[model samples]
Target: MQRAFLPSFLLLSALAAGLNEARAARLVAPATVQDTIVMRLPNRATLTLTVRDAAQLRQLKNYHLDSLTTRLATYITQAEAAAKAGTTNQVTMRFYPDKDQPGQNLPEEIRITAHKPGTDGEKGPTKTQVFLNKKFGIVTTKDGDGHNSFSIGTDGNATANAREDSLKREKRRRSASVELGFDIGLTTLVNSSSTASLQVPSYNNWRSTYINFGLFYVQPLHYTKKSKLAFTIGPEFSGNYIRLTGNDQWVQNGNRTFVETAPDAKQIQQATLYVGTLNLPVMLRLKLKNKEDRTTLSAGIGGFGGTRLTSNIKTEYRLAGTDYNSEDKISGTLNLTPWTYGLQGEIGFHALQLFAKYNMNELFKEGQGPKTHLLTVGLNVLGF
Candidate 1:
């Protein structure tokens, strides 16, 4: 058996989970100037973990208190066994960093110490990486080539062309693969101004939702292969919803569209305008950091142009005398812009990303409907 004891702070996280959420919050001290947190257990064990950067803050945000408590308990039990078999009373445990996983993510690290300072002190350097595949961990990494690389290793000194080559290899391997994308986010009007003649109701930004679905060809930028930049083209369909804040409902008269209060306002439950479009997007993608095929941090900026496919106003209401509810879906041109183009950008870790789009065209034709453009912000997860 080995003399082992984790920093006591990490051990508290396991116990803290059992407490009420409010109490547990008190147990976690805010990160210090050094971005390190030290948590102490009631048993006098303390744990300390350092946050390297703001990106690592996402890892902390992703932690699940429930699963962590269970893991900590199990780890403590294993330490007890190790201590019983060996002569050392000290025990140590570690947590790995999360690498853009879909489900519950991993915590960066937790150190628990049971004894006073320097008690059976293991002065070994804190190791950040763990390579379970020992056979693959070659002894020497003297050259730049990947002949002695570890699993999931990335060369920070890689040239721009090397990154381009990496992109090319990815394309060659999945050239036939179709990219399926789903985007969901919030929508708002850039201009909510209304004139005396045109009464435009302000939109409820928080309630307005946007969603999109797309199937596209992942055509990499062949011309930029020698450069650090990469580009792609794709096709897709997207939908936007604008929920008016007041009782005003959309009114469409031929090519003209405006908003007016409903006759029976009390009966209305929900009023929302929906618009759909079919789109073609050309994007420039850049990877900030990579872990083999897994890009740790990536970003993209692009533009899209799409034609309006469908437009309708949906209203839900309940009957005054009865408990019955009804929905009214009135389809129309609504004087909305026939075609639209916009600039979009995204920044993300792995496949989960945050995106924003600004529509260059107005939501409706000049002098019709609300004199406003569309702006959308939300998160997306990419898949093959």
Candidate 2:
């Protein structure tokens, strides 16, 4: 009887063990195929989720799968719209596991962040955050920064910034500025009769040291988008030094002017005539190149009126073969013109200008000396 009871116990134990093994096999068996969902976030990150089994995939379909897809579609639509409008946007979605299957592994919440197109209306970055309920505890995972970041598009709207910058530059270009210029040229007497007793020396004896310095207020005039003109008015200080070839004294005999050689004159070291004037110049300049260009071509025409500040004749001499030297500066003795007027013209590329001027008035007072005009040709160095 004890042997029979032992066999029954062994058989019962084997059956129970077999049943437990079958149950474990059913729980651990792999599903026919795995299903997955992939989501892309605004910040260029990817989120991939694998369903646990066929039952879990079915549950997702029956529960909130369609609604989730719909919500995501809505978010994309809104984000695209906002981008078109040059704005930013965000979206949030909830993914709930089936209440009937509390033990099912499913995400609890999903948050989507998107941005509108940038200034150019192009698609921007996105971010996604997923909250999951795990066996250990609730866990949070993020694929991106979860912030909206926009991209600049190629649309015309992007030009707004460029246009603003261009406007600023244009304003500066059109603003008022101070200008300075230097002039150097040959100074000579014109329209003089050769037989005149008070004739100035010819060009061979003339000094090419005429210099002028100017300071001006320049105002730009804009007539069109690409065209510009300027009005410049300035004070110019000018001086002319004329050197004579011979040792001669310029003498005034009551009313007549003559150059006389001294009896003791052996060698004429230097004889110079100096004239200083303060002039007022009015000019109009037309620019031939676009204002944006670094180098521009310009043409200018102007006139000047001036008063003679001072005039003098200086002579330096030495006795022939002797160390004796003499120098004399005679001022206010030459009957020079008290007033002067001239027409000036210039052509330039950028800062370098070639200029010419012709004096309309005589260099000396009428009937006091030979009738002569002043002609100047030189380079004008301009600065901003």
Candidate 3:
């Protein structure tokens, strides 16, 4: 009888030792910020676990060891299963301390939730809850709202979503845009022939006005992330008015052009010439700042070439100085060039733009009239 009892006791002792070894194998050191725990699930998926605070660290190291690990492993399995099934892989788990033992040195209630992929099969948002004290807890999520009860996904996808959003905004900003604007400028004759007797319009009496209506298509040329420069090209209708002093009218005799007092006119009041053209303008516009506010500084330089559409001269005179009521309107090409080309520049602060233009081509055909260039200066009333 004694020998049989001894054999049973030894067998029981051996079983107890095996149980102790297994328990020791499962135990681990408390988690710290420097340590990251990685668990490989049965489905060949990985779950990375982290401790956010001291209380969480203590709970992970001590209380409900088997229960917590089992729950986490189950969550990992479900996430993988959802991924394979093409469904939402989100999982939420809530933990609460045992209510029966109020004085126990155990952690308070906590929640862990993982987000699922969005419609595009990418991870959505994540949320983690940590109890800092018995009465307070901290919740964090990729979205600003932290009060959400469930965390849907992992944090690995937050950065990708942010990058996608940024790209979309940039694409919208770089899109092509069209704008309408009006241009007005002062004009004068330049680079005239020395031998020509045609008097240059006096600065005091010669009033040059350029009025243009245009539609511009602008494309942004990005040199840097914050830099803004644009290429602009458009078509415009321009009407140029030049008022010559005194009652003089421009006349063309064969190959010579001259200005003289209008025939049968006494005391000329006003003599004006109008030239209309259709212009194609190209420009480079630069902004000193990235913002569109009116306080920013901007500059532009460009050139234009076009064909003259019409030309006319108007004369107003005083018949023997009797109230100066006579008026005459004439329409002709006046030997003006059929085509025109010029260089233009603009500078402004915000919406106010000042412009200047220098015509490179002669105002009239070769040997047909006085050789003169046109210069224009004025303001752009409708900012582009």
Candidate 4:
């Protein structure tokens, strides 16, 4: 009977022990910062977790926040000076913390200090001071502290400084891959058809075809491994020609009002002229994905304002087919000059290319019978 009672008591004790262990496992301590704080233990010494309101809890979580803040602050100042070549007057900083490391246990503590380019002690510590509190998990330090300090484990500054140095090294690698290229292509005009039965009553109609060609040089303002921005300014020359046709019209203005023995109407003759222009081009260029073997497409729009540097027109009468040399017949004062403005687009494949341009401005003078539209399609030698 005694042996049986002993076995029964031992079994009851084991059952009670198991129930208590389960209850303890279910009871979790509430975290002050987390609305739903979950503390996980990955092993004897590590933790895995997530934090959503790190910024709101920054004051309470000053140590980690300070680590991120100091790292960002150093990066901003150094990056700006590097970008502008010691020309940056001010700096801005941002902080990003590890969201997956939120638990009662922390790894290490660090403090970061910035030194001038050459000297270690001349700056006399960092320019600003940071203070932290662990109980509230916040940065409780006042602004009066010239130096800021955050406490997690102790090596926060060293870690932050290492990252800042890495970024500086990367920026140097990109600025070395920049280049500039020059290009030139021919521009030609297409002509319209003329009819003999449609002779102008007052003025002769004239038309001509011409070609212009030029070279351009561009320089890169900024260059990185992947992108480049450039500015181009250059001059161009154009050759022009003109063709003329004859026109005449007769009208009766006088009626029988004066009874002057049926007055006859008189016929009037009219003339047309074609002019040529020489232009200068100025433009800006931007290229993206500047890889060695990659195909890149770039577009540029510019205005070419030209002067009537030269002019030639040939005149012919409709009835007699008589050819008249109108080249010297019209003076610069009597003839209208040609001026134009255009926009251009280009697509590049590897080092080969295709280009197109449209002239937005009218090609003819004010009173010309028909309006002209100039379009150019060609290949770009410079694959930029």
Q: What are the TM-scores, per candidate, against the unseen true structure?
A: 0.53, 0.54, 0.55, 0.35
Q: Residue 368 error for model 3, in Å? A: 1.8
Off by over 4 Å in 3: 1-172, 203-206, 223-226, 252-257, 262-265, 290-295
Which candidate should be chosen as best, given lDDT against the real structure?
3
- In model 2, the Cα lDDT at residue 315 comes to 75
- Best-fitting candidate, measured by TM-score? 3
- How displaced is residue 73 in candidate 1, in Å? 57
Best-first order by lDDT: 3, 1, 2, 4
Model 2, 1-384: lDDT tens per residue? 224333432322332222111111001112542544433443343333344444443332222322333444454556446545553343333444434246544445444444443333333444333333331111111112223222111121222234335545745676778888788888776777745466665433345468999898889864233446889898989998876655565555665555666556467677777889999988888776664664467788989999999888777888777898788787884888889898999888776778888889988777887677888888887633
Error of 3 at 104 (Å): 26
What candidate 2 gets wrong by more than 4 Å, as runs, is 1-166, 194-196, 203-206, 223-227, 252-256, 261-264, 290-292
Q: Candidate 1: lDDT of 164?
A: 38
Query: What local lDDT does model 3 show for residue 179?
Result: 87
Write one digit per residue (lDDT tens) for candidate 4, span 46-120: 111122334423323323332344444554356434433433322322222322365532212222223323122
Which model is ahead, 2 or 4, in terms of lDDT? 2
Superposition TM-score, candidate 3 onto the true structure: 0.55
Model 4 earns a TM-score of: 0.35
